[model samples]
Target: MTTFPVEQIRADFPILQEKIRNKPLVYLDNAASCQKPQAVIDSIVHTYSHEYANIHRGVHTLSVKATDRFEGAREKVRAFINAASTKEIIFVRGATEAINLVAQSFGKSQLQAGDEIVISAMEHHANIVPWQMLCQQIGTVLKVVPINQQGELLFDEYLNLLTDKTKLVAITHMSNALGTINPVKQIVEAAHSKNIPVLLDGAQAIPHMAVDVQDLDCDFYVFSGHKLYGPSGTGVLYGKQALLEAMPPYQGGGDMIRKVTFTETEYAGLPHKFEAGTPAIAEIIGLGAAIDYLNQFGMAAISAYEAELLAYATEQAQQIKGLNIIGQAAEKGGILSFTLDRIHPHDIGTMLDSLGIAIRAGHHCAMPVMDFYGVPATARASFAMYNTRQEIDVLMQGIKSLIEVFG
Candidate 1:
């Protein structure tokens, strides 16, 4: 087992100390959501307790303070993804909403009848459904790039799908269901070769690795703050400056308008055009603090530690009889999805929970991938920097007990 500063990190999250059925909590459901550190919790409380005011429409001191904090969070998001400017970052409720915003605004503007929009088989419903809805609305065709049995995208098949008729290609940087880390840089380059713009669903990638939007050259990237140790109900969509300016506004409300007129109303620029009414002021501030907290730890260190944890868990899991791990992508993130012989994934999840171990069991919002694998669901254990080898041992023991009981 690799030695991580697990004790030191565990101390930062108070919720990890709680007991279930008199057993210490072993949180392995990080892919669903991560426990927040004190820094993030305190930041949220501080924002609401000390400075709570509506932003961008008032002249009062509190409003000014709120606006500054809110916009500062935008800058933090820009820096987090290495976006070119704050204008490229638009805050929404979560990755789902951010993706819908782009699909409705940018997609509606770009796609026409018989136009093609490509996505991967491993895409979450949030990434797939929005494009499908848009395609249905505009009479466009939605194409899916197939994945191999190992759950890795078939890049050659993806390349073949790109053509002059392809208007947009939406894909996931990392599969939330399978833990497949896709070659997004190469994917983007290939799509751009055919003049197709790419939108990356980064909900799974942002929390696990360092993402440089400029380096990837993707047209749009979306991720949720909750998955990155920030507050819930907060997310960001980063678009290239030109694309954001060209796309129409998502929602028409108070902040999105430049001037109100019955005859003709002008829309605000880049971010404001997308951000409608009063935003998630406190959550945005907390997200900024979360970014600050992660920066202090250094993303390189976090990535390395999570990779080690994943490898250790994989080795331990492979030792169990009648166990089959899914998504054996050459490049994977911190997620481990698997199944046991004749045992439903939901049963495995419930059994683990009895031992104070948390995991995700379902299609994980990627029903296509599940269908491709011919499985109803999978039990997923996702690790973070705070997870320890002891937790993995507990998980392994829990699985062994389950096998003995069910076998």
Candidate 2:
């Protein structure tokens, strides 16, 4: 195995050199959104500065150039996730919008009243709320598979939830709050056995690991670009070609239509059918640049390095007095969620920020997970490829100082 060039990787991100509170920035909130590499930032600047135009609607030179880069980004996303084709990739605002699109379009078309949609208790609000809205609209039932104390999904319970009534299975590939990496392949296989389609919320998983939608055989997969070290307001929804072809268009406007008339309007096919209106042209190009940047190190390298970082962080965190580390699943990603005795998470986060240690302090948009763990919020230090062992040391130092003050 090649040695991970962590310091070299850190150098590529311009924000790593930033100062917060007169101290070097230790960015550990990567699960919320990653710091962009210089390459991605340059790509955005180049696109808007040199070739800014609406794509797919104009025959002008700039428009053509913009369209090529935009569509090229879709192909990059396809290859990044090992998707079958570019046609299967639909650009959305983010994972939230993508989930809503599927819920509204596919849920309305294929499912009926009383049909069940199975999701895990550990899903983000993006994964939960959209389906709840769908259930309210169509009178469908939302069945949640439970998780154990360690934050691992009860596998038998998940399989039991898959029955004749279950129309769809939407679950997170990795928990944003818990750092739990669910057995997605097994989950997909169980759902597929019942001929049920599966959708994976890959917002947390995509940055740390390589994802092959075909290998997992999931009907749908969604991830946000910002979490993957790309620009905000850009994401991808990868669905099976046959399934996408079957579902109606998620939105209606502009390039999504083949032909329109006062009396008759026909929608486009496959990917274009779902991507409507003026998309984030510059951001999409930047996303492609982000993919190219990540390709240099490969996902395996990133995953391995982050795993090591997480292990180190966990070991140090366990030594902290009266600090209870949450989510001790057998398999986890890079998140470290915990609660300190006699101190609120917000206080912990605020104290850490004074030391230039950045972390997320809230329910993490996974209130259900918080409810399961019976905490109002958690202090989450999520790692990424650019993070170093030194940063973790800084984080631990901050935590220890905070505890000493509180104690």
Candidate 3:
């Protein structure tokens, strides 16, 4: 196993050195948003400083240069997912918008009354609500695949849920709240067996592990840039070429049309048909820089190091009195969620903040998972590649103090 240079990597993120409440900050809210490295930050600055202009509609020198960088970022997203072509990658605002794009464009055109869409119990609201809205409008129904107590999706039950009426299956590659990594490959294979297209919510999965859209053979995959240590307002939606070509334009506006007249208009090709209005040029370039940074360390090495940290944190956290850990699946990412007996998660989070340890406290945007577990909310500490085992020690100490003070 290759040893990760965690300390060296930490130096690249200036925010990690920040102090909170007179102490060094131990940021454990990675599942919410990862800290951006200097490389990504610089890329944004460089684009605005030297490469600033509107892309794809001008002949000026600045516009040509800016267009190259913007389109180059598209290629970066393309290679990152091993997509067949750049035409398959559509830029959206974030995972939320990406899901909406599929729901409104593809779902509206293909689905009819009494049709079915399958989603899991652990889906983020971004994956759930859009489909619900679409279903409500078209008189369709959503079939939910239940999970076990361990937060693992019941594979057999998922297979049984599929039928000819099922138009699509959407699932999260990793649970943002539980840290459970679902068997996405098998899920896609089963959905394909039924000739039902599958969409994987890659918002949580792409940051922690390697993703190959072609390898999984998923029809659509979406993720946000900020969660991957890039800028906000930028995301990628990877759709199969045939599907993208078949689906109608999402939101019609400028640049999506080839020729416009008073009576007739011709839409542009696959990706441009989906991407309308002025896009996020600088943020997309920053995302490209983030991808370049990830390639340097490789996802395999980062996953291995994070696994070591997760084990250490879990073992130490289990020793805390009156603390109940949630979502103990056989396979997990870097997230750890737990609640204390007779203590609210918000209170625990506030106390941890005084000690400069940041963790998320809430339902984590997955109310269904919380409802299933019978908990209102939980305190979550999710790790990343730059995080260290020493930080886990600090987290344990903080939790131990929370228990003592509450008593």
Q: Taking the tens digit of each residue's C-alpha lDDT, what string does model 2 give over 140-223?
A: 999999999999999999989988999999999999999999999999999999999999999999999999999999999999
lDDT of each: 0.92, 0.94, 0.93
Off by over 4 Å in 2: none
Model 3 clash count equals 0
Colliding residue pairs in candidate 1: none
lDDT of 3 by residue, 1-407 (tens): 24798988999999999999999999999999999999999999999999899999899999999889989989989998999999999999999999999999999999998999999999999999999999989988999999999899999999999998999999999999999999999999999998999999999989899899999999999999999999999999999999999999999899899999989989999789998899998999899999999999988888889998999999998888888889899899999999999999999999999999999999999999999999999999999998998899999999998888889
What C-alpha lDDT does candidate 1 achieve relative to the native structure? 0.92
TM-score of each: 0.98, 0.99, 0.99
Query: How well is each residue in 1-407 modelled by candidate 1, as lDDT tens digits?
Result: 34556677789899999998789999999999988989999988887888879999889988899899889989988998999999999999999999999999988897899999999999999999998899889999999999998888999999999988999999999999999999999999999988899999999999889999999999999999999999999999999999999998888889999999999989998789999998889999999989998888778788989998999999999999999998999999999999999999999999999999999999999998889889999999999889988899999999999999996
TM-score of 2: 0.99
Q: After superposition, how far is residue 159 of candidate 2 from its true place, in Å?
A: 0.9
Per-model RMSD to reference: 1.1, 0.9, 0.9
How badly does each model clash, as a count of residue pairs? 0, 0, 0
